[model samples]
Target: MVLNYIWIGFFVIAFIIALIKVIIGGDTEIFTAIMNSTFDSSKTAFEISLGLTGVLALWLGIMKIGENSGLINALARFLSPVLCRLFPDIPKGHPVLGSIFMNMSAN
Candidate 1:
């Protein structure tokens, strides 16, 4: 929620500054520049996501294979001692432990 306010504040500040520039400095193209930059940034972001698509797909595919072939379970069992120590509040065989292990494995 705090992040939302901060993001809104950023836009509000930019708009106020841009308005001042337009009124006092007679900079008519400020909003156009802002819009162009926004579009360019979004395009670049989309491109980055497109570039990562293959790698993301392969990673999820490998994880799925490991799950189906029991490698994930084997890994969880192998790391159970350390994980159990790290997460003392979680019961030994809790379902959440599997997800925790999977998330850790992703990292």
Candidate 2:
């Protein structure tokens, strides 16, 4: 959590610096012009980030749904034999084998 806060601080500082540069470097007009253009690059960037986050959320939700639907269990069952063969030291029917298979399938 501390690391997360530190990262947030870094981003805030970076954003402040960029804003200051734009405002004080006689670049405010250029920035305003860019913002006025139909392209609106800054807005585009924000939209892209929003879309990416939404897509990530959708994927995570889908994965959770798949988990509840037993897709992961089926995959684990299907891969268990191959997993057991790959890790001979792990007993054939051990719970660890299923876990390993599940982790691999998740990845």
Q: Which candidate number has the best TM-score?
A: 1
Error of 2 at 12 (Å): 18
- lDDT of all predictions: 0.89, 0.72
Prediction 1 TM-score vs. true: 0.79
lDDT of 1 at 107: 97
The alpha-carbon lDDT assigned to residue 49 of candidate 1 equals 97
Q: Where does the lowest 10-residue lDDT sum fall in candidate 2?
A: 29-38
Which residue pairs show collisions in model 1? Answer: none
Question: lDDT tens string, model 1, 65-97?
Answer: 988887877777778888899999988767677
lDDT of 2 by residue, 1-107 (tens): 99999989976776676588787895656545544653676688899999999987987787778677877667766777787678878865566654575567558
Candidate 2 matches the true fold with a TM-score of 0.43
Model 1 lDDT at residue 6: 100
TM-score of each: 0.79, 0.43
